[model samples]
Every structure is written in structure tokens, then in C-alpha cells.
Target: MLRMLFHPKSLKFLACIALAALTFSSSCKTVESSSGSLSEKSRTKTDVFFAEMYKKYNPYPIQDDPETPDDCQSLFKEADPSVPYKGVVVYFHGFTACPQQFYEFAQIMAKKGYSALAVLMPGQGRFPAPFNNDGKKTINGRKYKDYYSEYLPVKKGDDWKRYLNFVSDVNTFAATLPGEKLVTGLSVGGQLAAYAYVERPGLYKRALLISSYLGMPGSYSGRNSTTSGGMLNSLRRLSGDTIYHITKAVSQQGSNLDIIADREVSWGDKCYQQTRGFNGNPGRRGICDFHVENIAAINSLGEYILGQIKASPALTQIPQIQYVGPEWDTGGDTLLVRKAIGYQKARFGDDKVNACFFPNVVPHSMFARKDIAVLPETPWINSFMLETTKFLETGATYKVSQEPSEETQWDGASDQDSGVFQNRCDVYAVDYSKVSP
Candidate 1:
């Protein structure tokens, strides 16, 4: 028996157990309290949460990769501590996107005497190489080459817990800030923002959701090909460590890196060509990566929000809300926006809800700097900033104008007539119950 126990296979098994123990021990350090201001306490909690999360999922220290940009890092823009400013705006960026998505908006807020902190979502704002461990050696094997770069290595249930913890900590910090508290988010961030609002009604004075992803559009769901693949991947990850590693290695061996890179570049170019006001530079566009597990996590959150709205038809203390939707958004159904507005109004009176739809302009990333409307005739960015300031200051709502068509020439436009731009804005009136799933 002793001789059998000393076999090479047994030794390898022992080593794996030892490794797992070490990983767990290192990742589960006690969070220490630090001496600082009240705001610093909130920051400390956030830092500690991420530290444990990174240790568990990404055991290796992050290497200094030249490919990563500074803007891709998380940001906390503090207002003048001396002056009593209006308050803080806690901004959350979309899925796979970095804090840079809201960095400009934060700056605009800062300039207007309001502090802004753009919280980086868990598993975001990192170099893409860390997540390329799917064991693909070629582009053909990787169906999502163009959009798979810099994605988070999310392992189902654990990832969602980490994300919720992040949201909680950030909101706690927002409470410490002076003046009024405002929360804003885009895409998945929007979903999280809605969760934050619903979870802590009185916490935020106002909330703005841009292209909130309540549900997948019918067209998008029909076109999706990775549902089965994602299910299989989730199963593999849930399997024991030995089996998971073996399966991952087998999958990675067949991929071609050069082909993957070429495809990524080609896709990026196409996106630039199609998008108006898009900076020609590569990688400047917000993350195009998609992870099925992440999508499922966001969807779960959305479902929870809907359920909560249904359970308590009237919320105790709902904040003033602005629901901004894009007519051309492909990620989420426009009808869901209508549904959300309807639910909010039903729960918290019609006067509490406001809705705006930008027609013939912008995608799901409506509030992102890259997607901000910048037609030559319309300084949409400035107007949006002013409107945001007004909303935050007095809870005032602006109706989307139905202006006549103007012949505006966009970048790379042909002589063909580009139709007029229409703005659809209204108070919540639709009966959400009547809408189909």
C-alpha cells in the first residue's frame, strides 16, 4: 500500500490538492481597516473586494502589458472638497467596457461642480490576453474572434456574486459623498443601476439609464449561435479541476493566433466604417467582446428587477428616473424600455418617470463618448450635458423634440439623401402588461 501511494500519479494528485489549498488560502485574506476619511472607507471596501476577487479568479499577478491603455483603468474624480458641491454621480460602464466609457461624462460633471466616480465593473478594464485561455489556436475554431478580446474569465455564479458586491460597495461610497446622489449606467451597467435603485430606493436622488438591457431583442436572440457552446463551456468549468484543465488544453491546441488577429482587425475596420463619428483608430471603440455567462448574469439581474416591480406594485421611495433608448439599438429591445418606464410609473406615479428615444442615431452605447451624437448641425454632447445638469439640480424632465428633417452630411456620406432625424420623447403611458415577451 505504501509503495502504491508513492506512485507518480498519486504524487501529481497530491500536488494539485496542495495547489488548490494554497490558492484558497491566499485568496481569502481578512480585509483590514485603514485610517482615512469617511469616503476613504468606502474606497477601502471596494479595493478589498476586488483584491479577493482577483486573487481567486486571476491567481497570477497582472503583468504590465503595453497593449493596455490608461483610460481603460478605473477612475475616481473628486470635486473640490472645500466647496459644498451638489453631490456625486456614480457612473457604471457597460459590459466588457472600461471606465473610460463614462470618463468624459464624469469630467463634464466635475467641471460643473459635481464630483464623479466611474466604477469599473468586476472582470473588466484588463488586458484581453488573460481571458484567451479557451484553448483555441486558430481563428476558425474561435467563432467570436473580433469581439472576444479582453473579456473577463467569468465562472458562472461566483462572477455574479462578485459583481453584486461591487455594486453594493460603490453605492455605499456614493452615500458618503456630499450633496445629492445620482446614479447612471449604460447597457449591463444600466441593469446594475436599476438594481441599485430598486435595492436602495432612497440612496439615489436621480437615476439615468441609457440603453438599459432589460431583455434581448428578438432579432438578436435569433442570430445568436453561442447558446449551446456557452452551456457546454459552463459545464466544463463546473467540472473538477483536473477535468477542466484537460478539456481546456485540448480546445486551445487547435487555434491559430495570427488568423484571429487578422479577423479582429478586419472586424474593427468594418465597425469604424459603419459607425458615424467613430474615431478611425482601432481599439478606441468600447469593448466589442461578448461572454454568454456574463450575458446570463445580466439577464438574471433584469429578471429580478422585473419580479420586484411586480411583487410590490408601489415602491416605498423610488427616485426620479430618465430612461434613454436608442431606436437603432440592437443589443436590447426598444419595447423593453417602454416596459421599464411603464413599470416605474405604475409603481411610483407617472410624474416620477421620463423617457427619451434618439431616432436614426446611436447604438446600444448611447451615452458613451464614442456614440454621443456629434452631427455638424447639432452639438448634442453639450446639450446632453446641460440637460443632465438640469435634471440633477431640480429633477426637471425634458421632452424629446419632434423637429423637422434637416439635410445633414455625415462622415463618408454619399450624395444620396439622408433622411431627417426625429426625437421621440414622452411621459410613461404604455401598459407593460400588454407587451409581449
Candidate 2:
């Protein structure tokens, strides 16, 4: 495996993963190859993005057990500061996610003429864990207690500290640079951006949150409320005596051993609602389902976090939010985002809260619904780049209501279970001059 991808060879590295199962989506779609080899690109040849070089930082040896670093700073492991940005981008990853996964998003921002900095939050990287398949027989599978990267559910109130430091660190890093500094986050990263926007206002000029939620109250489901005792994992190789940290590992079991409430409404339900499986796994369907919390937790977390953000003291309390997504996302996250719109220090929707609802299918979700006008499928991986860079420059307005156009199947409505949706919304224009001058 090391021979396969020790260095960043975009083309050949993809081929190597193809030989192995590069687990992705249920849709079996082909991700476009990144145009060039980053190997030739001038990165400081740093092995791991962050948290490596354990020996240099700590005087005493560190143990993986309930791992805690004494000197862990309030900031992130930054890239070379000498690398300037015409525009600054501070990025965050999602649940059970790795900073490496946002390569597509980062590349997109870079291509859009921005200096992109992505952060890997604590409890989200390579933490050693044992596989949970205590099976009957070991068919050449020597039954040894082995370790793998799995989702170590964040203990209650723990994620906030990590995110707070991450946001502050990103802000400090971006402040020293020049150009339009924008904060963008995917999945949970979006949440971080919102928090940072509120807490450390004016630090980021704009926020691009993809597949994230805004403030809302939660609907609880009866379930375990325990501090999940597992390790956050990364997808690295298990070398002879030590486990190598490659990509981050996600959990198969933990406090989230089962699906969220409701068999139909939740994103997890929608993921499994599909007839086809993704990346060969039937369960890993839609965006919401993949390692998501219950709706209540989602709402509570959003409210708790974004509320703190909204209440925070920023230079211009309200940083404009450009909400973008397909119908499914529009109805799901936008509803909560609308609530968040009002909480911003700036007046809500005074061109400060922009929305764009795509009348297309979001690629990261289950494909079980009608996607007659699904946007070009190829742009899945690269959409973040385009969307983020484009939005910061334009800051245009968009809103798509669920109301069907004249071309509706039955007076612009379907009898089948279409789930919740939005129509009659608009797409943000590609170009907008001075923002709220």
C-alpha cells in the first residue's frame, strides 16, 4: 500500500485505489480525476497534515489510551505561513471525517484563486480501535486483536472545545494574510464556520457551509446518552508493531449503533431508503445517514453552536450566508438555516443571508427520488470549490420554492412520496459586484 501511494500521484494513486475498494457513494458514479499531479506542486513535503511529529512536541512519551496532549495549543497545525493567499479560505471537515477527504473542495478553492487551509479537528483522525466482528470462524483470518480506525463518538460537550480552538486558530491564521478572507466548511465544518462567525465576528468575511444546518430545536429520540468510549480512527495501514495513520477512519458502531429516529424522514432513513447500495455498502446512502446524529442532536447542536456564534461579537455581526443545495438539502438544512439567518448580528436577509436552491439531485445522498433535472453529475467532488469561490465573489441571492413549474407531472405535484421539498426558488447569480456597499 505504501508503494502504491507514498507520494501524491493523482493519476496513478487513483488507479491504485481502484485496485482496492475506494469506498465512496452508492451511486457508483465516476469522480473526475484532478487535472495534475500535486507531487510536482510545491507543498512543504509534510508527511501528515497535522498531529504528526509527536516526539518533538512532547517531553514525555504520549500514550494512545484516552489520548490527551499537554501542549495542544488553541490553534491548528497550520501550513507554511509564507504561502500567501490572494483570498483566504479556512476549511473544516465533517463527522467521522478526515481533512484529506476535502481534497476536492480544497482544490476547488485553490482553482478559484484562493489560498485554502483545511483543518483536521481532534478526535477525528487516526485513533486505534478494534474491529467489532466477533465472527464464528477465522477463514485465514487469524483471530488476533487488531486495531483499525473507527469513529470515536465525541463525549458530551467535548466537540465544542475542539471546534472553538480550531475556529480561533483559523481566524488567527487568516487575519495575518491579505485578500478576502472567507470561512467555508463541509458537513460539520460548516457548523464550525457558523460558530466562528458569531464568536469571532468579522474574522471571516464570508461563510460557505455545505451540507450543514442552522439553529433549530431538536426532537429527541429514546437512545443511549453515554460518552462513547472508542477511538477516533484514520485509514492507515497496520504495520508490523505499529498502526500507520493514512486517511481517517469512520466508526461502524458506538453510541450510534443504530439509525436515527423515523424510518422515512431522517437522512439516515433516506440513505437506506434507496434500492441500490453505494460504494458497495447499502447503508451508506445519503448525506444525512452517513455517520449522522439524530435530528434532535442535529438541531440541538446547531442551535447551541450557531446560537453561540450568532451571539458572539463580530465586527459586522452578520456575515452573509449563501445557502446552496438541491431540493432535498434546501428543505432539510435551509429550514434551520432560515432560523439562523435571524440570529446573525447583522440584520437577516438584508442581502446578508443569500440562498440558492438547485432544482437538481445532490450527489452525496440517496438516489431513490425523482431527479429529472439532476445537475451535471460530474461536478460532485468539485462543486465545493466552484460554489465557495463563486459565492464569495458574487454574494448573489437565490431561493427555490417547492412549487413545481408548469411542467409538473400532475398540476405540478406528484402523488408518490416525494419527501419534503422546496420549489419556486432561485439560483444565486454568478456575478455580483461590491457586497452590501
Candidate 3:
């Protein structure tokens, strides 16, 4: 049958050829389903996006040396039984970021009563095989020249699928940890965390998304609208066939789950002040600094996370929600998670589903005050780990989410984007005393 060669390992082009042959042999099949909510829509978008991406972007195996350092299992902490240990803190590295990048946070969480797990994803941990070229640095076996562009491998719509599979994988790993686990993603990992919250809710107690783009869903631009229209038409024309192929692929782990960067990014600030350059303001931070900022990403991440909590399957309201970023005490990441926990307690108290947003926190410091680039640190990170540990142990609650009109978000030195920041809420915390019945 023409469908014979159509498999994941079926190297894209060959599948096209196989589909071509099948055209002569059988009738077409199409897929159908019901959906609503951000998660479902995001998944739908991701699937369509990846399918299109695979057609354009080829996934070649890259070279990676799978080395497990002795420091792998170094992070661990005792879960407080007084309160349920929702989950451990698992750190995922960004592109080319090895376990080293997260050592500070990971070790701190472990000491703070969390069983921390830090692993690499894709080009992160180990290079994919297909070796050649003296083993220096290469992707798909070429000397690593244009890494961010070529190897990073992202497409416009893959956000959802990438998130879904990633959470599934993280959960599988969490199951093996000392206790339940929460996710703390950085940069690209943070983006994955946002999508994962939508794709897989309740998998973690709460998530900390740092320096990520948790933008809005749905296509708005004329180009995306038009492309989406064509896709709909194509799906209609080859409904039967498309269904068969997609269903089969989805059955096999959503093979089309690759994320590609949007040539023209749509939602979120195209570029923040820091993202552009240092500009010379005390409040003004840069992309490199924010990448290490927890709160900035959290505010954006919180918007989407609130969606995840609202859309939760079990509707298990968490005791707390936290996002730590810069613009806090001394421009450090003093935007504690405790505040968000308090907020969740106030609004949807006792449901246990808590979500909070902290601002960007600068870790120690890297360069001169102006040119200084921020990264995560261990000593300062210990606080978050301790708070999380305490939350798990004491089941403490907090209140942070106050009425938006009541608070002035841009009052101080904020580099907030319009509609995104300007209008914000007065702060409150969660009430830990109330737990779900």
C-alpha cells in the first residue's frame, strides 16, 4: 500500500513519495475533532505548524556526546510531609546550555527540601548522532557555525506540541524523582513551560517561567489568516488523507512537534528596552539580563498560566503561584514567589490553584553595572527553593492579585509594553490556611 512507507522515521520526502503512490491505490481520509480553550487551540496550531515546518525544515541528526556528569544527582531536599510535596524543582537548560548553567538553582532547591532534577533537551544535553568533522561543535555533523539559526530548530506554530510532549517527558521524569516535581524553565525552556502549562496542567504544583515569550494565541495578521485559510482548504480537499496521516502521526507522539521561530513575531513586545540595548536608564534592563530575569517573564507567563489553572482538568487550585524576576530589591530577583501564593489565596482561595507573577531578578551581576549581563546564582536562588520547600512543608498561603485598577504598574521604573503592562493590579497574597476539601 502507498501508506506502507509513511512513518515517523520515514524521512519526510519518502513519505511524500509514498503518499503519491497511495494516491493511485486508495481513497483519502480526513481528521475531525472538538476543541476549545487555549490548550486545545494551541495544540491544533502546533500540529498544523509542525507539519508545515517539517515540509520546509529538515530535521537532521546533530552530533552530541552524551556525558553524564557526577553532578547530575547532586540536587536534593527533604519534602515536608506537613504539607504535600507537590513536586520537585526540575531545571531544563536552554539551547547549548548544559547542566552547568542551572547548577546554582538546582543545588539550592535540593538543599531547600526539593529533589531537584536538571536535564538537557534536544541539542541541550547531548548532541544527536551522525558524526563527522573532528567532534568539535557541529549540528547534523557540520562545524557549529550558525547554531542559533540552524540547530536551535523552531517554527511558528510548534509552541503547543513542543510544550505537550515536553511536559509528558518531564512528568515521566518527575515520577522517578524523590517526590512530585515542579518545573522551572529558563529562556526557551520557559517558553516551553508556558506552553506545557496549557498542554499539560496539574502536572506540577506550579511553574516558574523565566525570560520567555508567553504571548497570546490565535493568528491575527493578514498573512497568518490567509495561510490558515489555505490550510483549512487543503484539509478540506484532502480531508480523508490528511486525517489518516495526522491521526497516525499524532498516535505516534505528534512527530510534527517542532517549534520554528516566527519570521515576523506577532504577540508580546517585539523588543523590550533591554532586548534592544542598555539605553542608560537605571530601570532599563537588556535581553541578556532579562533572560536571567524571573519576574518579567512571569508576568507574561502568569497571564497564560492563569489560563492553565482556569482550564485545569482536576481543577486542583494550588496553594501558591510564583514568578521571580528583576526590578525588585536592588534590581535583583527579590520578586519573591510568596507574594503570588498570597494573591491566589485571595481570589480563588482554597481551590489550591494558585498563580503569581514576580518581576525580573538580576543574579549577582556579570559585567560593569551598565554593561552587566545577569545570570542565575546559587546563594540568591536558595531563597526560592526554601520558599517552595516551605510551601510544600507548611502549606502556607499568600495574597498578591489585587484589582488592576487599584494599582499603578508603570508607576516606577518599569520597561513594560503597552496593553501588556501599563494597567496592572494592586498586590495581595494567598491564604494558605484554606485547602481544597
Number of the top-ranking candidate, with TM-score as the measure = 1
- Error in Å for residue 157 of model 2: 5.1
Model 1: weakest 10-residue lDDT segment is: 25-34
Q: Please provide, for model 3 over 1-437, each residue's C-alpha lDDT reduced to its tens digit, 9 standing for 90 to 100.
A: 12213433335435433443543110011111111222455344334432332222223321111121111111223333344334467665443333344544543344345555554343221212212224343444533333323323332234333434545555564655455557766545555554554455456666654433333110110111223342122222323343333322332332243221111111123212222223332211112111111122223343444555445454444423434332222221212222233334454563543333332233222111222222233333333444444444444432334533211243232232222221121232334232211
* lDDT (10s digit) by residue, model 1, range 294-356: 444555566566676556544577788887765535556444555667666776787788766
State which candidate has the highest lDDT: 1
Mind sharing the TM-score for model 2?
Answer: 0.51
Off by more than 4 A, model 1: 1-70, 81-83, 128-162, 219-286, 312-315, 371-379, 402-437
RMSD of each: 15.2, 14.1, 18.3
Q: Arrange candidates by lDDT, highest first: which order?
A: 1, 2, 3
Cα lDDT of model 3 overall? Answer: 0.34
Residue 66, candidate 1: alpha-carbon lDDT: 24
**Candidate 1 lDDT for residue 304:** 61
Per-model TM-score versus the true fold: 0.61, 0.51, 0.41
